[model samples]
Target: MEYTYYPGCSLEASSRGYDESVRFVFNALGQKLIELEDWNCCGATSYMSTKETISLVISARNLALAEKYGRDIVAPCSACYTILYKTNHILKNNPIMKAKVNQALKKDNLEYNLSLNVRHPLEVLVNDFGIEKIVSKALIRLDGVKMAQYYGCQIVRPDRGLDDKENPQMMDSLFEALGAENIYFPMKVRCCGGMLMTTYPDVALKLNKEILECAYGNGAELIVTTCPLCHVNLEAYQDKINKKFKKDFHIPILFFTQVLGLALGGTPKELGLNRNLIPFQLKKTALEATK
Candidate 1:
């Protein structure tokens, strides 16, 4: 029914499209997403690698706020979700890390409590909204559209206690609920080279483009993913990938929430479908297909 959302840095800027779309989609579905008041960054995966405690503290601050709001935090970005959930797990299970993180978090007048749970929108949709409820209002069936549902790295790796770490079918039921044809791809949990996107643009570009090629070659007309970072690395790098590869494979990659919003009869604008810079010039056939 209701949940607080934490949109990481990418959603506010580079992933505004995702931000707007998730808002509209969930709203249309009678799901109320109240964002945490004055919520800060999740510190992302980078912070975790640089300094585990600092990253934990930052993520804990956000998670702590969700606790204050008395609602679980639903994060759309996979990276954001992972960091928040991981930190929450640590705070709940590891007393030493918990105390340290709470002390660091107090600098911002906050503390992490197991009282609040960190969830991805995909998880909330199924667990909270229920599969039958989501299917009840599907106006567009994605059965005709062949696409690869990529979870990238964050959603599955380290398991995070959400679903099977290596073999994840978290978003499958959602896609099926909307009548989308999801191709079982081995690379679903594979990395989009997103970690390298910032440090090594060229490498990131190549790897992301390769994911595109592999999916398309396997009869995929589009690729659906969750993480904003993954979306930026894959969707934003289209031109460079095209130029480097010297190929015209322009498969439109879309956010998982955007696709869910689309199938639920939400308008393209509401779903932020037009927010993509890659220019999806197709209409009527509903080729765009999931998070």
Candidate 2:
């Protein structure tokens, strides 16, 4: 299957691992991801709170561009996925708002008929490609690798129909099929404090501390997430969280795609695993056992 790929800003920069692994995994699966040319930001969560129209217009522009491709637009970033999905939903239901967005697009010789679908790579992989197919392609099995699948706050919210909002199982099911142990993590869908990390460091640090503490307590060796912001908040702030909370926390935070790519025969360097702040390495015995 082919889809229009929108990497958003984070994937292009801070989450390069996600970008690399996403491209590697999709290509390995024999699926095609045609990146949307001249794509812009999805206006994220902040813009909606301030400039609603401008946010919708900017988000819709990407949708308008993707419409021309006549294919679903797959967004790797959770914030981008939620923003674009919201833009599609609002434009489809609100005629007045749709008119305003279309009028703005007209200046650029573009228009959105709300004919596009905004999807997350997780949903696309599990739903479109099928877990069985993914399992069949595995070159490595994560038999005893304990992982906490962190979905964060946005992806399942506003009823996206991607998975269970409160308790998502898509990631769990996929990893389980690949032989990874999915730890019982209740904080999987909890807020990772998102942009609050910049605005309110104390609050964000506490939030991330809780998440890491939960994962560690549950015996998770690593935390796998779908959101770039979540990954950053949980991974980059460990030292700060440790300092403030008076506790030691050093858990490897990884993108789900990175883990999946390893199963699909991708190398650690190729999947950007070496770039992680806290290092993680699967056992050589496990690797040989899978072979």
Candidate 3:
């Protein structure tokens, strides 16, 4: 199971834990990831609204490289997953748009045939690795941890209907394999304001705060998400969220892969858990009760 790795930017730099643990887990599962060379940003949320062509071209370029290798590309970041998947899907559906995107690629001597299969890392794990394989490795049991799997859009919408759009169980299945309890919540696919953290931070913060509150209120001390944008907006905004709301909540925002990393017998450092802005403060009774 070898796939081209597209870390985008956030995972490589800010989400080192996501990047690190994903590598560790793939290796643990005997899967190889050949990271794309000279990859650039995937033009996240703003790309779709501001410059659609450039956004498609940027992601198309990344897929072009994947075609050169003739392997599927796995994007761990939610934004990268959505952007790349959108570009690939549209290019496959509209020939004229595909031609224009291909023409746009000529500037870099790249031509995209939409042959590259763009997949989210979560999809690869469930479809490629299989839940049985993950269940077989139960080193650290999370049986005590009742978790809420937060999808926050992207992975399960529009492009790939891999999981139940209304209710995704892939994350729950993985957590169940590790012996954790899955608390099903209807708000799994809700938006987390992504880059709006910069453009409209007040709204972003309010939204971010609500997300954590909702997750905790629903019986999850930890949130397992697949998007880098959501992770950034949710995790980095914790202090501001507490200050703004005048409350203290140390709910940990973890990548779905990071949870797998811990279950793979990797330490917090191996999983890049320490890089998080808010302490996952398990010392609190609310969190301690989960364990």
Model with the higher TM-score, candidate 1 or 3: 3
Q: Give me the runs in candidate 2 sitting further than 4 Å from their true place.
A: none
How do the residues 235-283 of candidate 2 rate in per-residue lDDT, one tens digit apiece?
9889989998898988999999999998898998889998889998886
Q: What would the C-alpha RMSD of candidate 3 be, to one decimal place?
A: 3.0
Decide which is better by lDDT, 2 or 3: 2
Clashing pairs in 3: 143-179
Q: Top lDDT: which candidate number?
A: 2
**Residue-wise lDDT of candidate 1 within 1-291, one digit each (tens)?**
788988888899888888998898788788899988888888876788898787888778777777877877888888888888888777888999999988887887877668887788887887778878878877666666677888888777776677777777768777865666777677788788877977988888878877887887788777888888788888788778889889777778788888877777777787787788765433445544422
When sorted by lDDT, best at the front, the candidate numbers are 2, 3, 1
Error of 2 at 67 (Å): 0.5
Query: Against the true structure, what is each candidate's TM-score?
Result: 0.91, 0.98, 0.92
lDDT of each: 0.79, 0.93, 0.82
**Residue 139: error of model 1 in Å?**
2.3
The TM-score leader among the candidates is 2
Where does the lowest 10-residue lDDT sum fall in candidate 2?
282-291
Per-residue error (Å), model 3, residue 163:
0.7
Candidate 3, superposed: residue stretches over 4 Å from native: 281-291
As for candidate 1, its clashing pairs are: 256-290, 256-291
Error of 3 at 172 (Å): 0.9
